[model samples]
Target: MQQTEEHHSYARATWQVVEPYHGAVYFSPEAHARYEELGADNRAGYFASRGAALGPASAELVIGTFYNFNPDLVHRALPAAWQAASPQRFLAARLAGIDATLHRVLGPEIGSAEMLRAAELAQQAARTALRHPQGRPLFAAHAALPWPDEPHLVLWHAQSLLREFRGDGHVAALLAAGLDGIEALVTHAATGAIAAEALRTSRGWSPEQWTQAVQRLCERGWLEQGPDLALTPYGRERRQAIERTTDELADLPYAVLGQASCAELRRLARPFSLALARELLPWAVDRLAAVAD
Candidate 1:
């Protein structure tokens, strides 16, 4: 079914509002500690835990699914991370960390009726996503896991599925726009949604590789030369089109769930999202700013 503009807005809104709650594990000290216990360093912890859903996935698999990280960085982390800990162990550690992190950030709210309601609603929408997982390998992998019994954990896991479902579509959109992994990062930085240096370093792209991507974007007339990375008008339009396509692809679950239920989920999830963002997400300012624009 073709998605209406209204449904697209709901899909994007739902994603932005629920993001922090699902994303806290990435920055949670508790989660990091758990991965460390399994002999995985921070990078290994991130790659292993996120990729654990794919079993003992190869670096090529992770690199292809993850879409934007440096392939060398992926190689440095993968099979090695599996050697340090099995995918099952990595999954367990991530859940344990999420449990600890949510308890610390959300406190008494973890057991609230509101939390359960949010969890139930999010899960319903997530189930809708599960039906259409043909090309969404990451989402399909995560969906194959059993649902967590706890309300807060259920909510977190549901959002994880929904986010990855959308993310897979976003990757398709980027590819359709003819952007490679490095070019994707460069164009995103050019939009100023994130500091170029911050994104470049975090993705493990060398300064030289970053410059090359920037030059590629410039040659495509998608970027402008200056002291800093900047997107030309055409670039901005192209990026917007990519985002629109992504939102449309992601609209199915929310559209199936209907607007009112999604609104309630947003309302119930927002406080938790805000609390998690305040405590765990310093980098979210970049994302929040991008949303505002």
Candidate 2:
């Protein structure tokens, strides 16, 4: 086995794309918001545990890879097949399905340099030198890839592999709003209720701003629209946990931004001449708990 720590491979065929372990690292603005909320609630631990693992949907990807499922399965399956095939047939089968399939992971054409590179990385990581039902294969490979899209195949495959290595099972019932309308509209009542209260007591926002925001979310199906705004079941589910995330994080000490809500806080308060002063610095960590000092 070539230990990456001792001898790194720069060959394109040797590496794969990578994503961060925690789902919060999805790294979108919304994801950043979620991370902030979770951090404030002292829930960084939730991510700490899964730091380099796959996201919530990892299981499905795993089962798919093992079973040769999904549209791209054949291409994925082919390289591994070649690896295990007899030496005589290896080269002949090397480019199997190269022309027949359009792989989203590898792009529409398998003939591309990128596609070949991916096949090589996956082969080196899991297939090449594979010993059938028994021994752990040596000559392994590794790569840090980008985050997979929701329901992504390669991402799922990578996650499954990680879980097996660690003997960890990624299971949880945290509610996820499909954020699509097919879901029941009634779930968010509680969260909407919370939002409504927040809005009512909200100091800077105008009725129109709050109402417009709520209405926009309602139209987008983030919350249920009604005579009085409230969360749908989905919203309820997320709200319950998101708020808990804040409290969980609050165990650490943070000076409340006096009265500043999240919106009012921003990174690098460079405009404030007193930002260097301990007392007047406007920054707050994610939560009252989880202080870095």
Point to the candidate with the largest TM-score: 1
Tens digits of lDDT, candidate 2, 182-208: 122223333432243432332223456
Off by over 4 Å in 2: 1-198, 252-293
Give the clash total for candidate 2.
29
For all candidates in order, the CA lDDT equals 0.90, 0.28
TM values, all candidates = 0.96, 0.21
| lDDT by residue for model 1 (69-176), tens | 999999999899999989999999999999999999889999999999999999999999999999999989998999999999999999999999999999999999
Looking at candidate 1, what is the lDDT of residue 146? 94
